[model samples]
Target: MNLNPDQVSNYVTKYADVLVDYSLKLVSAFIILFVGIYAIRLINRIITKVMVQRNLDPTLTKFLSDILIWALRILLFVTFISKLGIETSSFVAILGAMGLAVGLSLQGSLSNFAGGMLIIVFKPFKVGDTIEAQGVIATVSEIQIFVTKMITGNNQTVFVPNGSLSNGTIINYSMQGERKADLTFSISYDSDIKKAKEVLLEVLTKNPKVLKKPAPEVFVKNLTAASIDFAVRPWATNANYGSVVSDTLENCKVALDEAGISIQPYTIQK
Candidate 1:
């Protein structure tokens, strides 16, 4: 059936009213969203300041502040949409579906992010500490939201995901002030054990880096199939560990060679 011109005009006016109403509501929603986001940021800053005053870890405080702001902003957006007379249940449903898809797509990254949060909160290790984690030995350079940056002994920077790091074992060498350098060397069974001990003691006495209180230990540790093993355990500052080990090995070799002691070798047959 053909509609009359007057009736058609009336229908168009009704449609225009709905469009105008919807547009006004959308504009109001956007205004609330902008203002709410700014307010959330201000609140986040205040919370961050409070956390700092309470002596919270800076990393944890920053993370918590960000999460709080995000949560509040999301709440405000949902409220704004509801005020616009939109069915929020459908919006929430759509959001949940999209969130699930995103979460699945970034499952590993999400896990790492969660793990990073745990690390920051628990503080198993911090930036600048020498740590062994996930079979990588390096100094922690930075702790990020989903990964930890490490500088290896060879001056290589590595980014390790926090999920694997948190799930694995972490050896923090910087926790203790003093670290023991346990050196093991083998000698021929015919060598003079007492004389070898004397030579090691002399080397320890001359080294100023070695701690005097704990003192250095030199003793026969074990008798292997091919040679006798001697252990030289010494305590030194963690910073001097590499130097002490290198110097001690060089000096011990020289002293033993001068004293007519020979190092035994373990041979493997093909």
Candidate 2:
């Protein structure tokens, strides 16, 4: 079992070549990793700047940028592995399986996230907007990736899932910048219809909160055994809607009383 000098030299040279190749691969992988990280950061900053310039929502901009960075980093990781001559197909298969499992388990969350993206993109509502959705009328306090935060009239905080909110009907009360307050006033059947209409119209006209362009209207809405109802419709800026309705009601009562019109009780339809 004797080994010749030539045979020993050949073994030493082959092993040295393998070591050098591995060392080179290691250095290349590290260099690509550092450079890839820097490039991801640069791209993220550029994207953020562009989004800001376009006046995109801060929350959306950050979320999108983070997603892009992570995706890029994953690609860079795969490339680094490939550079080392390691089997990447199996690694990628494992990643795909994991992603699919996670996605299936988080269906609702993913749906909500997608819905949130739609809401932010389409802008059906915004913060401070009074909206009617999911059988609740509330002012939107905040909008997030998973849910919308609202403050109800009773001061209760509500968290509505974005998945349902985006898919369901939404009434944005503030989008039009104005609102109509539909009011009904009742009087004795014996009351003068013409005079009651005049009194009611005068009440709305005198209220500064009510808009003047559309002009307020008073008309006979219904007649019942107990009373005659007058429909009072007034237009007002969204900010003044509440005050206008309340003030008009109070003023109409006083005006009708002064005019000798007998007011009666009746249900008011919203």
Taken over the whole model, the C-alpha lDDT of each candidate is: 0.87, 0.91
State every prediction's TM-score relative to the real structure.
0.77, 0.85
Which regions of candidate 2 deviate over 4 angstroms?
1-20, 57-60
Measured by lDDT, the strongest candidate is 2
Instruction: Point to the candidate with the largest TM-score.
Output: 2
Q: Candidate 2's residue-wise lDDT over 1-270, tens digit each?
A: 999999999999999999999999999999999999999999999999999999997767877887898899999999999999999999999999999999999999999999888888898998899999999999999989899999998999999999999999999999999988888889997889998998898888878888998888889998887889899999999999988888888888889999999998645556
- Tell me the tens digit of each residue's lDDT in model 1 across 94-173: 99999999999999999999889889988999888899998889999989999999999999999999999998899998
What would the C-alpha RMSD of candidate 2 be, to one decimal place? Answer: 2.8
Please identify model 1 stretches exceeding 4 Å from their true place: 1-35, 83-85, 265-270
TM for candidate 2 is 0.85
